[model samples]
Target: YGDLSKPYGTGNPVKARCPPNNVVWYTLESYLPTLVYGCIVDAWVTNGKCPYACKFRYESNPEPGPFISAVNEVITRGRKIEKDRVVMYRNLLVERALERLKEIYWQWLKLSNEDGPSLASLWSTGTVSEIPTLKPFCSLVAEKKQLDKASRTLVLGNGMVRREWHNKAKLAKNFALLPNLESGDLNPHFAKTALMDLVEDAINYLEWVIVWPTVVQAVRSTPDGQSHLDPVIVLDRS
Candidate 1:
């Protein structure tokens, strides 16, 4: 399959540049739950709903850890200034990827939400694998135009049905699992399984929308044959 991450301005696949596969890819699915839980906590704190913490706002501050401190220390240890900048740039990429992941996570949640768009009924069916066939002109302009009662009722009915089918393609594209055939609340295990699935799906999407594009752009922007450290690109999907 053609790499979707690389831009094809000329419509020629042969012209698309493929980077080396030597980058160390970290499997971060194990940490997804914690990251999402943090987003949830952020939301709570932002809304002043957290009892233990004061109201909070999301900030773009670089994440703090021993790794960050080490990077700072290394930069001061007479490393080439260019290499130091590369290290900082890599970390900036990680932060940007995290921001994109957060955006996609909330977007997916809203799309599949109970009352948002995709219907719980349609979600459980095999039909979710296919794009929804929605009717256009679902508005009740028929009534405004003083159409027959029968036509007005039909328009209203279709509008309600279309509302249920809203964003069905969005869910199908971002979500992986075919939802359970049985309809009911999830047990703790099942709920956790679903959350993991969502994270995995979101990461796949991030690779397409954020990771690949960013990687390609950064590679292209660098001077050809410029020597630098072999960097492991941590996507920070969290």
Candidate 2:
């Protein structure tokens, strides 16, 4: 609000913002179908980079291709998620839908788009990889909701139910956000926190679901002290 002299340097803040890269390196318009465009858009938006670490290049027109209007719509929705902080469930649903769509995209590309006598394969190659699934993380939300409802209605419980619900929700939220998390090529710290939270959740959940049950079972069966089952062996069998 103070200075307007140096427009390019500071005044024109809108134009000073960084724009996303364009899809110029790959012939997406020529090869990929229009329906799969949204998947590419989601991958780009969530990761802040093009799918498969595509080659960077300059383009006169920075707009998305005409065939990729669907992708633009999805990007618009992600913006709302960033603002309101709600609709996480909807975002997860969108990720799953795009994951399914990309399967068809990859199959079609493999059959139709083939490089002819190109030495590019010797050096490197571009590929549309499978987007990870969000099912396990989504399940956490549902389970948390159940715990929350039980906590409210339980007539005899103390604080155990509510505490468990909060713990599970935190874990699930960490995992769900992993799909949208991006690791910067220049700065490694961008994705470290989210990745660590996810790994911690997995380890804790595994111990609760698999390890604890086996240990209890082994302890109960060996009350006579004649024989004992090793916890490691039980978990390994599991």
Candidate 3:
């Protein structure tokens, strides 16, 4: 079904209808890593941009370097405070847990419509009118005591737990620094503004790690961004 006038199938209608190979194929070996690094760098740079109006006091000439340093310091301090805040939040969680446990214990002791203590009351008060020893409930009490001990240990630990608690305390202290901001106060606007800055700085620091010079060097050393290919053509005469 081919045309006889064609040589090497070049003039054949089928050959003329063949798809073109104009599209180039590139497979950069390090493209993915480079792209990821670039993304991290961009993200960090974006994070470094301040969200709120920051006040600065100039000692001499106001340069971007000094301004940046001041801003970075603020971000660092804020992060430290945020870490501390997490500890406070954990403490509050423990307190709430203890309160819930107390509520359950009280409910279990309350009798019916009559103004009398239920049998469970003897377990808590150790009454001779009932079982000599409510040792069965000792397990529950022991569990609660263990939880309390753990909480106390976490509070007093000299490790990360302690640091976390200290940081949370520092965060609380910082909030009190603003005379306008009072204890047990909720200010969405202020919190949102402060958190935004703090988050941005943290993200920026992460980026700095991902796009570090050493990482870039390692990426470059490998074929992470390189590619290779070859093209060949054949001809025949009859």
All-Cα superposition RMSD per candidate: 20.2, 27.1, 26.7
Mind giving the per-residue lDDT tens digits that candidate 2 earns over 1-238? 1111111122221335452122211112111232333444344234322344454543523444322233344345442223232234234434433443333222332343253312111101122111011111112222555445331221111111122322233344332332222222101221132223322442234235434556778777775635644433334565
Q: Over 4 Å off in model 2, which ranges?
A: 1-26, 29-35, 38-85, 112-238
Question: Which pairs of residues collide in candidate 1?
Answer: none
Candidate 1 lDDT, 99-150, residue by residue in tens: 3333433243454554443422222221221332211111222233333322
TM-score of each: 0.19, 0.18, 0.19
Writing each residue's lDDT as its tens digit, candidate 3 over 1-238 gives 1111122223222345543221000001122223322332332233222212242434332433322333354456543235565444334333332232222223333433464543333221222122222221122223555444331211101111112222243343332232221211212222222233333454345336434656768666766335232234456765
RMSD of 3: 26.7
TM-score rank, highest first? 3, 1, 2
How many collisions between residues are there in candidate 2? Answer: 0
- The lDDT values for all models are 0.32, 0.29, 0.29
